[model samples]
Target: MNSSAIAAGPVFSARDITRVYRMGEVSVHALRGVTMDLYRGEFVVLLGPSGSGKSTLLNILGGLDVPTTGSVHFLDQNLTQSTDRELTQFRRDHVGFVFQFYNLIPSLTARENVALVTEIANNPMDPAEALALVGLEARVDHFPAQMSGGEQQRVAIARAVAKRPDVLLCDEPTGALDAKTGIVVLEVIERINRELGTTTAVITHNAMIAEMADRVISLSDGRVSEIRRNERKRPASEIVW
Candidate 1:
């Protein structure tokens, strides 16, 4: 964690949160007494195995889900108390999400795919500029099917960031790519965090990727097992699978 970001206080404060899914006779606890804070302009990695609740926590933070118990406050707003419509607006205005899949439109070109978000966003970047930020300047006219996996993922990243969101949440962003391509994606994420100062949280099962984060948050069985801050963060370019 950057000391400066810590000084700025938390952008997100989640307290004593619990999420339960009821399915007929069974109840699944996706998050159990989870409490965490995401600071402004910091890069955090959510490290965990499957069923560890990292994705659940990310979803809650992104306003896609609400906790069954406890509170989530984003700056002055109480997310847990927000209505579905309010949450929808919050997501629209503030949050950006990238997942394992590219989630790009098949018929749309790279610039067109990113333009979708920019069109709905307030004070968004030009789609071409956003694509250039992800090193896809020359490929803006290419369709998702025409680009490589890494390039497609970069388009997804560009779309997510074009709105100039305060926070970026990515779940297994590099899961679909090979090591070389994954590193390229990681580099793009790192650049965004450094340049745009977006508070970023990425979910990954790969421990090696944790080295690039300012802080690594480990989850186990629906709880935060540990939180470790790196004294000196490693560059994504130096990381290997």
Candidate 2:
């Protein structure tokens, strides 16, 4: 971990971010003034319960949604107010996302599934190289049905990292796996961040997973509850979750 101070400010900056949904008339506040900075090459873990704004925050950060009131800046670009076209380009060009589900196309081979993404990216690595990064070179042509959960997840990671994105947003990426399998998936993610220097943010309820991050931010009731810098982060295998 050895969290260095957020250098040169933040690569991704959120300020007093708030998101409210209106049904009929009354508002349901999903994000109640959550603010944070994600520095480049930083591994950040966000911990929170359901309905605690974790996913909402991630969505906003990933350009899938916008804040009800607040600001988000990616590098010097104002993501909060970016036009739809601009945001779409930003997402395609600079962000890579992984979710709880593998989301692989059942009919597509692992390499093809990954290629579906990289083909549209500006400067992507070959799908083969991406799969190799996740230790899936041998399974390149395997379909989702032919892969184990961990292996499928590695394919998802391969798809994400092939684009050389500036930021990687993962939402409960290992939520469905057993502890042992989850660690393997987490290890792949950690390795990608280390090797590519991607600014990574992972949202998970598993508290022990925080030990694998450079900084841990806990959310509660739509707000940031605590932020701690890990003095030293152990490898995923050393984590006791």
Candidate 3:
């Protein structure tokens, strides 16, 4: 890995971001002055225990949520200053997200699920190509009900990336699967980041997954505790549970 390449300004930069949730009389602080940068074409793993604010930060980066303070700049665009409509367009245009659960429609086949996003994208890949990228070409005609948990999740991943978004934000992507199955899903994600050069960020509690990331960011109590760069990144298949 080239230090100069990593030092080049990040594709996504967050500065002193904070998120507070008000619950009736009490206010819950999810993120306290969190600052970070995600460089272009790098796979980053966000490691944290529950309530560590990893997901909140991911959501804010994906434009699904906003911070209470500070600013987020995706490339040169200031996301914090964008209106709701602009944020919506930003998400559709530049971001792709995958969650722990495979939120595929039961009635839709894998191809149709991916087509849902390609239909609206500006310069989208073909639905079949997207499914192929995730190694799901053979399962394109299968409905979500007919597929295994990992397969359905792959379909979800395909749908997310069909639009060829610059960034892929995954929140606990492998959280619901068994170890072996999770590795399979992780491999697909790794392949996408490698082959498509998508700037990927995955949130996970599993420390083993950090081995596959170019950089591992650990969060504690709504703050970034540490960030470590991997000298030799390991393949996801080599990650032991």
- Candidate 1 per-residue lDDT, tens place, 83-142, comes to 999999999998999999999999999999999999999999999999999999999999
Give one digit per residue, the lDDT tens place, for model 3 in 1-241. 3566478779899999999999999999999999999998999999999999999999999999999999999989999999999999999999999999989988889999999899999999999999999898899999999999999989999999999999999999999999999999999999999999899999999999999999999999999999999999999999989
Judge candidate 3 at residue 206 and give its lDDT. Answer: 96
Candidate 1 residue runs with Cα over 4 Å from true position: none
Q: What is each predicted model's overall lDDT from 0 to 1?
A: 0.95, 0.93, 0.94
Per-model root-mean-square deviation over C-alphas: 0.8, 1.4, 1.0
User: Which residue pairs come into collision in candidate 3?
Assistant: none
Best by lDDT: 1
- Residue 212 local lDDT, model 1: 95
Better of 2 and 3 by lDDT: 3
Q: Which candidate would rank higher by TM-score, 2 or 3?
A: 3
Preferred candidate (lDDT higher): 1 or 3: 1
| Candidate 2, pairs of clashing residues | 1-233
TM-score of each: 0.98, 0.96, 0.98
Off by over 4 Å in 3: 1-4
| lDDT string, candidate 2, 7-121, tens digits | 4678888999999999998999999998899998999999999899999999999999999999999988999889999999999999999999989999999999999998899
How much lDDT does candidate 2 score? 0.93
